[model samples]
Target: MTTTVARVDVVAVASPKRRRRAPGWLAVVPLLAFVAVAFGIPALAMLDGAFTVRDQATGATSYSAENLSASLRGAYLTALLGSVKLSAVSAALGALVGLPLAQAVVTSRFRALREAVLTASGVLANFGGVPLAFAFVATLGNAGVLTRHLGLTDKGWDLYSFWGLVIVYLYFLIPLMVLTITPALDGLRTQWREAAQNNGATTVQYWLHVALPVLAPSLLGGLVLLFGSAFAAYATAAAMVGSSIPLVTLQIADALSGNVLVGQENVALALSLDMVLVAGLVMAVYLPLQRRSARWLA
Candidate 1:
């Protein structure tokens, strides 16, 4: 009886979510169109030329499988093999050396040391092709700094050889690997390490159970990137060995040059083969690791 009748009051409420219209990418369209015309079309045309044979007399381009088949022998094969071997060795060696450096950078006690190391690594990572080749030539080539100091100019170190190429490749690749792998290591959760230690896990145990599995995707990505960079490199090898060392890029350049390779058709085939090989290598790496990459990033 004492309880007053509750006044029933109802108020209309609106939904909290706001409806959104599809975003307009109007500004980026011109830039995309420019890239399509400028870069994409030219690249596709060059690729098409590789399959097509030209008649010098009439200046006509025709598709032929025969020219491509012929390129499998001689200088083309030699250069291609050399390029693959060099890139593979450099990538493997670089990753092996760089992974530990990345670990050090991420987990190091000294902030100043980490910053300095990372900065130096970045400089060396980007220092490739012309500048790198020149620096090494001055520092390690015949009559170079060390050789001159040791009075070994007469006997001289050869920077034009395969071993010399490997040395130069490693010099550039080590820093690259460090830069690539460091981000992966930095992405690891600190809590995981703390938990592992609290659970009485050893350093090795923690790495094997937690760190490595998480970092695998990044590692694979870095390795693939390194391989691609090494495989397609032209200027560094050229500056170091000139045309004496046969390489796919050098072959492509020769084909483009009127003086060196006589057959434009043959150059096209060589370029096509190089492109296919690179594409295959990338696919082999990418197809397997793409899913893993998403998970790792997540």
Candidate 2:
């Protein structure tokens, strides 16, 4: 009876469980709004115009594929092809020059020298457009300082021609390639080289079999980036050669400004879409390779 009485005390029941709150997504709202305003709206407008034609006389608009069709034909097509060729050649040359330059910088014993080269490359990569074109003109044009001093014009060197554009493009493209590929070069592990050497590999054999294989993805990614940079470039070419060079960007600008034709603004929009698609394709190829290369670095 005493034990039963002692056990009569009661305990309070536990409160009901509460749900955990989820993380807020409000932080991304500003970025989303900015993209919508700055890029999304303009992109939509371009897409709409690309497939539409307007009559300047009546100010009437209608849906049509004529603009796109026109973009793929005649001079427009030539401009597109020329742009591709220019971009490819510049990117290739940049890779050839920049890979070795990047290797030299990365392997340099002096920290100051490496820092100086990287800093200069960063500045030079962004130093394009009108000012860059002007610099080249002052240094290599018909009456340029170098041209006059070296008598290059007397040798029939034209700074306003296709080769001239390539040289100008290289001014920025090589630096851009260096900036892009430097990280990959640095990521190359010292241990890999030692291992190759221990296995009786020569310098060239080690590079060809091990180092190059590892760096290939990153190298290709950098090349694609350079190509896109050269492809989308407008100001430098415009300032240097104007429409004398048949480039897609120049063609787009001409159409928009009515410098080439009247009432062909839709054609310009179509060309813009085509450029976007090409860039998209480049990114499509690049992103996968970049990811693969990053895995090795990590």
Number of the top-ranking candidate, with lDDT as the measure: 2
- Which whole-number lDDT from 0 to 100 does residue 280 have in model 2? 99
TM-score of each: 0.81, 0.90
TM-score of 2: 0.90
lDDT, candidate 2, residue 189?
94
- The total of clashing pairs for model 2 equals 0
Model 2, poorest ten-residue lDDT window?
11-20
Instruction: Write down the worst ten-residue block by lDDT for model 1.
Output: 9-18
Which tens-of-lDDT digit does each residue in 1-298 have in candidate 2? Answer: 8766555532122222112222235567889999999999999999999988888899999998989999999999999999999999999999999999999999999999999999999999998999999999999998899999999988989999999999999999999999999999989999999999999999999999999999999999999999999999999999999999899999998898776566677899999999999999999999999999999987
Q: Clashes in model 2: which pairs?
A: none
Measured by TM-score, the strongest candidate is 2
Question: lDDT of all the models against the reference?
Answer: 0.77, 0.92
Residue 256 in model 1: shift from native, Å? 1.2
Listed per candidate, the RMSD to the true structure in angstroms reads 6.9, 5.5
Q: Report clash pairs, candidate 1.
A: none
